[model samples]
Target: MDYSLNEVQNSIKNNFASFCTKEIAPRAPLLDAASHEQVQTMIKENIKKLADIGYLGLAHEEKYGGTNLDLLSQAIAGEEVAKACASTFLSAGASNGLFGMPLKMFGTQEQKEKYLPGIIKGDIIGAFGLTEPEAGSDAAAIKTTAVKKGNEWILNGSKTFITNAPIADVCLIMAYNDREAGPGAGVTGFLVEKGAPGFVVGKPFDKLGFRGSPTAEIFLEDCRVPESAVLGQVGAGFIQAMQTLEYGRIGMATVCLGIAVACMEAANAYSKERKTFGKPINRYQEISFKIADMMIMTDVSRLLIYRAALAKEAKDPESAVLASCAKLFASESATKISSMALQVHGGYGYIKEFPVERLYRDAKLGEIGEGASEIQRILIAKSILSKIH
Candidate 1:
């Protein structure tokens, strides 16, 4: 019933915004301009910095060296971090939120004891390997296969566009254990270490945006792991992935919201500072309306994101539907808002000197990554149609 953030959530929002402004924002341009190798190192440093402030462990259990904040609080922190640097936010989430959260949610006691603390401490980097060359949105179409032999599991496949792949110390690899049974009952997830025999991480890709967040391919040819490497119950990988992605969608939305906010700020500031015909551009209706639309989208996206976050935290039955809704709106809004912001800057936005150029490029991945806007529409439409008589 509440529409506003409570005291603790507000405090988290303010504190994270302040810390990110002071520590993270300054490195954003540096990260954007760094070489692939250099950016990877800088992102590692950003991860450690986030860990030092407990941002890496937001909403996780206190026993695991986490801050134990609520999901809404975590979303708040995510927005601030993403507003500072989208690449850092994406990389950090790939580690703790995507990789570590699965372990926390489904890992055995020993798994938690071994990985959670180190992951939260930022001592170990993690990656989630699910999307393959063929299975970008259709996760069930992954060609990876795992077969049990004696006391070990042998895995073989490749994952592309994996976040943090170039630097991950550990990865959760999903594959089919019984292809005939389909993803719901056939798939399994295994914890594979970086140097495991036959497991090779390819060179980082030269990306158009999010250059600081290293993305690469993972090749596993007859990769072997002990029986203890299973992530959760046998035949539960598809459900686990679905569950993880539902939560991840909320994160994706928050980050997009952050990008929208950044766009609005840039546009508003530039409109007031830049002048045309001896008057500030803000006085022009064309410039003023674009800024107005940016403000409206940013505000609306925040509400949608928080609504989804609250639904998720409450374990609402319709949470998945809401998550998709938020993600679709926020992500598409980001692309629109960023373009407007860039247009507001005129020639300066096209140049690398202005952050809007980077924001424009970074805003695009949101619509495609996590889940595509097309897929979101399908899900939302299906959910609605399923309810009608």
Candidate 2:
């Protein structure tokens, strides 16, 4: 029930905000408009800056050159970065905690030693390859297969809609080792290096939002990796992916909360300056109501995100349910609030000059990625029914 952030968390939030304002905010638009190489250069520069501030691995263990902070701290920092540019935030999030955490948590000591240091240092990027062309919400039905061949595993399948895949140096890929055993018993995870033969990354995708962060399809054709690359035990990949996403949902919700705040601030500022009927737009009940709703939704979303983070940090069994609830409400609310902010801006909102337009685009990805709002609702219902039964 305690919602107070500790000193370290507060400092982290402040430092990240300062860094974003100074280093990221100014060039965000340029990066969004730049060519692929230019965008990559900008990302590298910012990532180095982020690493210098120890923001790259905020949630990892201190023993591995990380801050070892709790979930709330991670969420708070994510919010700051996301507020600057959702794509940049996605880049950092995927590298630090989303795809890398499971490896750090379940990988062998050799695997950790090989990947964790580079990831923590921000020298390399990582991605999770779970959602395939055919399997997104039905993760268990993934058709990617990895057949055991003596000391190596032959992986052959394609994963689409993989965030950070285009630039990732490593990937945590999920595949079926035994189709007959079903999702829980047949699935396994592998640590696939970028240069491994038969592992090909497709071209970057054009998207509605988060344009700075590229996503693509990853093709694994007879890809062979050592048995040591297997993460945890065979047939446990589904659970690992689910567990990782539970944590990822908290981060995604935090990003949505940030977008919501950005929408409200922009709307409030514009309403005051924009005049109608010989007075400021704020005088109008219609505009005022929209702003009020935006404020209310943003605040509520923040609380839900914080609650989920707290539950995760406390290791409560309900953490997954809370995370799902937060993700569902906060992401959907962000979409709604951003749309309203655009409406408040009138013609200006639709133009590229205003940040609200970009924010509106960014807010939509939250509703679709990191488990869609519909998927979150399904999770919530399952959780409730499980308890009831």
Candidate 3:
């Protein structure tokens, strides 16, 4: 019930917020002018900067180049960085949330040592490949195949809508190893190094938002890796992938909370300054009510996100369901709150110069990314039904 941040959490949140205010906030506008490749380069530069400050390694042990912070620190950092620049924040989030965390959870000690240090140092980026052209919410339907050939595995087929596809130095590629064994044991994860023979990065797509984060396709045409490259185990990829996405769901919740907080602040500032008839719009019940609603929505979202993060930190059995609920609620709240904030801004909100404009564009992705809203509901329903009777 005590929602107040303790000294450590407060300091962690403040440090990230101050850093974003000084660095990410000022640099976001330049994204409008930067080319696609330039934005990607900017992400790499930001990664190095984060590495220098030790923010990139927030959760891992010291020996693995991390500060060993808890999950709440990551949640706070996600919110703060996203508040300034969702795109750049995501560039890092996908690396850590989707790739690094999974490696930590499922990789062998040797695998961790070989790949994790570069990620912590920002020397290279990592990616996760699960969503394929034929698969979205239905993860089991993916057609990517991994055929074992002698001492190696040959990966073929393509993955679409992949984050960091074009730029990631390493990727956790998921493919069907044995379709006859079914989704649980048939799926496998391969650590595919960039530039490996037959590994191809597709062109980045032009998207509505998060333009700075490069998303593209990956085609593995007989892409081969040593048998030792398997993450965790050959048949447990499905479970690992599901668990990884639980982390990502919490991440997306944090992202949504950040956008909603930004939107609420912008509307509050604008309402106080903009006049209606003679006085400020904040004086009007219409504007005041919207502001109040936004505040309430944001606070509720924060609590849910915090709970989910706690569940993740504790390694709770229900963490997956909690994550889905948190992400679903927070993302919907963001979309609604961002629109209200835009309405408060009137015509100015529609233009690119306003941060609200950026927020509006970025907010929509929350509903679609990680796991779509519909998918979350299904997971929640399944969890609830299983608990009953």
By TM-score, the candidates rank as: 1, 3, 2
Candidate that beats the other on TM-score, 1 or 3, i.e. the better one: 1
In candidate 3, stretches whose alpha carbon ends up further than 4 angstroms from where it belongs are none
Poorly placed runs, candidate 2 (over 4 Å) = none
Residue 369 miss distance in model 1 (angstroms): 0.7
Model 2 lDDT per residue over 224-269, tens place: 9999989999889988999999988988888888888888898999
Residue-by-residue lDDT tens digits, candidate 1, 279-378: 9999999999999899899888988888898898899999999999999999999999999999999999999988999999999998999889999999
Write one digit per residue (lDDT tens) for candidate 3, span 1-389: 78789998898889988988887878876763478889788888877777777777997779989988888878887788888878877888778669998899999999999988888888979999999987989988999999998999999999999888878999999988999997656999888999789999999999888887889999999999999889988888988999899889988988899989999999999999999799998999999999999999999888888898898889899888999999999999999999999999999999987889888888999999888999999999999999899
Please give the ranking of all candidate structures by lDDT, highest first, separated by commas: 1, 3, 2
The RMSD of every model to the true structure, in order and in angstroms, is 0.9, 1.4, 1.1
TM-score of 1: 0.99
The candidate that achieves the highest lDDT relative to the unseen native structure = 1
Better of 1 and 2 by lDDT: 1
- Candidate 1 lDDT for residue 362: 91
Estimate every model's Cα lDDT from 0 to 1. Answer: 0.91, 0.86, 0.88
